[model samples]
Structure formats: C-alpha cells, structure tokens
Target: EADTCIADTAVVEVVPLDMTVADSTVVECDSVAEVVVEPVDFSLVDSVEVVEAVDNPSEIRLNWDDVNYIERNTSLGGILDVIVLGDNTEYVGYIIRNNPVSGIRFKTLDNKVHMLKWDDIVIYSRRPLDPEKSILSQSPLISTYTFAGLKPLEGLIVEQDYETGLITIETADGSVQRNSARITNITNRPNENLYTPKRKTTKRRAVY
Candidate 1:
C-alpha cells in the first residue's frame, strides 16, 4: 500500500524536441579557390645603403690670402683654374697671349671667348700656369740680332723660330714675303751726317 501511494504521488514530466541547422559553404573539386602566399624577404626592409656626400668640381672654397697669392703670380698668357672672388664664377682659361690691344683674350672652359680687361671684372685663382701647354716662355726678338756686323732691318721683326733659326717679319697684312737666299753687307745703309763742322778761330795767337 506504501509503494502504490508513492507511485501515485510521483508526477511525469514530458519535454518537446526541436531541430535547427547551421549554414555551411559548399566546395567543388574543380572550383576550389587557391590562396597563394609568396614568401616575404625581410632583408629587403633593412637593406637601405647610406648615401655619401659628393664633391663639386665647380664650387670651391678660397680665402683673400689665396686670392692675393694668385694676383701676385698671374702673368701674360698664364693658364689658371680660377673663380671670381665675390661672385664665385669659375673658369678654366688663360690670361691669353699679350694682346697688341690692352685686353686679355680669355678662352673659357666652354670655348666661349671673353676679355678680362674690364676694370670691374675681378677674379681669383690658386692654380699656376701650365708649363707644358701654351708657349709661356718669352720668345727671342729677331730685331735684336745682327748678321755678320749687320744690324737687323729696322722695325721689321715679328716672330722667330728658335728651333730652326728662321725669322719672320711683318709685311703686308695678308701678303707673303719672299726672302733672298743670302743676306749680305750690301743691304746695309751708310751712316749719314757723321761729320762735324769746324769752328773758325775766335782770338789772335797770344799777340805774338
């Protein structure tokens, strides 16, 4: 009777069940996506090289003493690598041949020619004249020479070749002169007006 009473007092509970599906992706063998991941080079990120300073050929540093040094040494037809003091204008040129005119014919590094005779055209340089380039030595004067006790033709000498002893004289501007095969004393002009006049006796001889 106690077991029946316990069974009648026990209550039965029923539970309802429901089913749900999670969404999924469908993959086909032929349509499978390929994700290609290339290997990254970590060394490239830190491979930057240090840049070095380069020197400029045209731009130079110079002082007043350096300029004074150049001014003291620069001469006719002297080749110098230089720059203007205040303006820093650079040039590779010469003082040029002593122009019959007063100016300097400065053949520039660029081949453009100029004259440095302007009183305002100030310049500076540290380099000396090149001994090998552009004849810098003073040439021998042909007029100062004598041929066998004969003086040179007056005001006629222009240039002379020291190697061959050949002499050149200024003739017509564009004409060539033919020289005689031999130079002789026959060409020498006689010295005129060499005699002095005698003064007449001004006083009697001591009154005897």
Candidate 2:
C-alpha cells in the first residue's frame, strides 16, 4: 500500500521504506517565487592600460655597426668608400664580410674581391647614394690657401678625410694631398667664398 502527502494542491506519493521519518514538516505555497538580485560593482576590477602607438614600430635607426651586422647576416652587401691609412689609396666597392681574423673583405666594381686589415684603413665611409649628385657634373676649381708659405693647389676636391685632417684634390697632372691644418681657407669661386666672415655692426648707446 502507498501513502499520500499534499504539496500545496498537488498530491505526492510516499513509498514505504525500511526507514523512520522523525519531526517531518511541510510548507505550502500559492504562487511562483520572485528572486531579487542585487547589481554587482565592476569598478573594483583591474583594467588593462593601453599605450600610445608609434607611427613606425618596426622602423630602426641603424648605426655603422648595426649596418655591418645586418649586412653580414643578410649577405647582400653594400657600397663602401675606404682609404688606406699608409698610402691613402681610395677604393670603392661592395662590402661582403666583417671577418676579424681575415680582415674586411669587399668586391670591387671590376669584379675583384679584396681584403684589408682594419688597422690599414683610415677612412671607412658608408652613405646612401644620391642620384642628384654625380661626378659627371662640372665642379668649381677649389684653391686652398695655406698658412704655410707654399703654393696653393687648385683642383676639384676628391675627398675630405676628417680623421687624418687631409684633403685629396684631383688635378690635371695627378692627385694631390694637403693637410687641412696647414690650409687657412678654401676658395671655390672668385668673389664667392665658401665661408664668409660675419659683418661687424656698431651698437647704439642710449642717452641717460
């Protein structure tokens, strides 16, 4: 036989078991219960801070060493202008290696590979090529006035060695080298000096 219990208006069947029910209680409801939920504050949560983006994130400012490192790794090579410290012989070619033991190796325009010791090189310059500047254009005859009582060499400047303070000029006869310290001034064109002195002006005094 089965027993019956009333849960509000619905009848619930109670099955007989080998267990005893003590202090049994029942509550009656007439309607569906409504839940009241309190709103949670999200202001206490930590937010991620955003940084200002740069215009060029991947763009790099490369130094001479950085350029060498990149070129060594890429093996593509780049143009280099170098001068020998002893003989002052100028060479222009594509630098291929940065060897410490064998020295710097480069390929010349004539398809010749040459290696020179770092100590043997005085001027090692690498710059971006400008299409506007060319040797084919007519250059002014530069005359370098020397502090020493010597005849000034008038020709086109081939290169200016800042490290050794020497200027190489190309003349009709051959290349000539001059010490920058010995030269006082360089005149490119007559009446149009390369460097001009500032004009002195008299200051007016206020009457007391």
Candidate 3:
C-alpha cells in the first residue's frame, strides 16, 4: 500500500507500474527548442558567371567573371542565380547577380528572368541602323552651271558697236557685224550658228 502525493509544491512518490521517460530527456527538449526557435540556414554562397558583358573588343571596356559554386545546402538562400551565357547581340553591361541571403539582386531583360535589381534589368542590344536614315536626297539648287554648260542658243545678239565688241554676231542675213564674237563659244554649238540678224545694235552714249 504506497501512495503519497500532496500537491501545492513538492511531495510526490507514487510508483505502482514500470516507468520510462527518457529519450535523452526528449532529445534535450528538442535541442533547446532548436537552438531558440530556428530560421537561419541560407546557402548558395557564390556565383557571378556572366561569361560576357561585351563591348571589350574594340575596347570601350566591360568584362566580367566569378563563377564559383560548391557550398551546397546551407538551406539555399537568395540571389546567386546568374546564367547569362553569351551573345545578347554581343552584350552591353550590368549582370551583377548576388544575394547570399538578402544582399538581393538578379538581371536580364529582353532575355527574361527580371525583377530583383529591377533598374529594368538593363539589357538592350538592337540599335545600329541610322546612317542618317539611309542617306540620299539633297539638292536644293545652287549652280555654277554645268549640265554640259547649259547648252541652248540659236541666234543670240546684243551690240554696242564702235568697232563691234560688247556682244555681236551676224553670221548670215547678208553678214557684216562681228567683233570676233564667241560669246563663250556660243553655248556649245547652237545649230552650229547659222545666224540671221539683220540689225541689233544699240549705242546711246553719254549719260554722266
């Protein structure tokens, strides 16, 4: 007959059956409540493999590297997922992916996977076709004259004759009116000059 249990603090001694309450004290209270309430297992430690950010050939400068990944499973945290591999029309810049736990970042636009560094992911390559809008069309007219020297004149005459000089040409119509008139070679052969000028001389001297 053994039964002694008086509550209100300290007095308990009642053992009637076999006892067993030890799994390392419930695994030490679940490892002290998982070390005071879990939540800190971010992995993926490193990766910046942007093989080519381009424009470094003729050299305006822009190259990138850093693809190191071997820390698998610390719970696999943020960032670190950059896979921008070559020729987005030969590249431009800005592919800095990183987030080893809220260092927050990502890239790529016209190629997708956006929204992290979201400065619009910055990726543009398709602008090189403006050689002045395909050039060819400019003639607003300003001439020193040369369509073969603007040739066109048959019987041209204007004279101030004192002995035939200020312009004169009477090769036909019973000739006799000429001061070696060649008016610049008669606009390149106007019907080979078969002139017909019976009189075109006006000289009204003295107006001073």
Which one is best on lDDT? 2
Q: Sort by lDDT, best first: what order?
A: 2, 1, 3
lDDT of 1 by residue, 55-95 (tens): 22235666534443132223433335443423445556654
Off by over 4 Å in 2: 1-80, 131-208
* Predicted structure 1, TM vs. truth: 0.21
Which residue window of length 10 is worst by lDDT in model 1?
Answer: 135-144
1-208 per-residue lDDT for model 3 (tens digits): 0222223443323333333221211122212131112223333323333333322233233222343322333112121223222232222222344443332232343444333432222222211122242111111111121123344233323222322243332222322333434334432221211222233334333322
Deviation from native of the Cα of residue 7 in model 3, angstroms: 28
lDDT to native, each model: 0.36, 0.51, 0.27
**Which one wins by TM-score: 1 or 3?**
1
Clashes of each: 0, 0, 1
Q: How far does residue 141 in candidate 1 sit from its true spot (Å)?
A: 18
Which run of 10 residues does model 3 get worst, by summed lDDT? 134-143
Query: On a 0 to 100 scale, what is the lDDT of residue 161 in model 1?
Result: 34
Q: In terms of TM-score, which candidate is strongest?
A: 2
